[model samples]
Target: MTQQPTNESRLERGKRALAEIDGEAGHNVVAALADIAPDFATYLFEFPFGDIYCRPGLDLRSREISTIAALTAMGNASPQLKVHIEAGLNVGLTREEITEIIMQMAVYAGFPAALNGLFAAKEVFARRG
Candidate 1:
């Protein structure tokens, strides 16, 4: 019998990514969207986690930092921000380090956005405790 290609499928990659990034968090997010938009959740898994996040250049901790920063800058993605905050901690970012990242954003993203991010971080920290 001929051997199959060693390359993995998107779903397999996505499952691996999910385990690394935020297995339960991503699962809950996708599960919540299953009824309303199943395809949307699949894309969330396939694209962000499988394709983008798994790329080796940035390491998981750095990725979460950038993700937290971007979501914090958006000033409207608190829910997602909260998830990334938890993700940051999972990847070994200390509580103070995460706080500093958000605080430093105040210079460019403005006080309101920084404050919102801080609140999101606070909530995440509380939950983890």
Candidate 2:
């Protein structure tokens, strides 16, 4: 099996992967990416979404949950993390599960990221209303 690259330099991949799951959110992610690196979002559209997100191995719900966990683990990504939290909810991850996940992250990702994740989750929850 070939190992996939986790290097975020592949912006189009990120955009594409994210777009597959949530097109509007993917575009918003691109907008956010503009603040960091303009070219990055372009690749996200191609690689991550087009290649990874469209893959048949994992279901959307599982992928979204995994993404939420991964983002929480990365830390210092309140904005993107929030997006994933919303994605998680959209995919049917319950609030209890989300809170539990965030709580679990506190041990590995530290208190700050976990706390921030909870706050981000709250924001996403509010937006749903």
What local distance difference test score does each model get?
A: 0.83, 0.73
* Per-residue lDDT of model 2, residues 102-126, tens digit only: 8788999899888888888888888
Q: List runs of model 2 lying over 4 Å from the truth.
A: 1-20, 31-38
Using Cα atoms with residue i matched to residue i, what is each candidate's TM-score against the true structure? Answer: 0.92, 0.74
Question: Least lDDT summed over 10 consecutive residues: which range in candidate 2?
Answer: 1-10
lDDT of 1 by residue, 24-67 (tens): 77788889999999999889878887778766677888888888
TM-score for candidate 2, please give it.
0.74
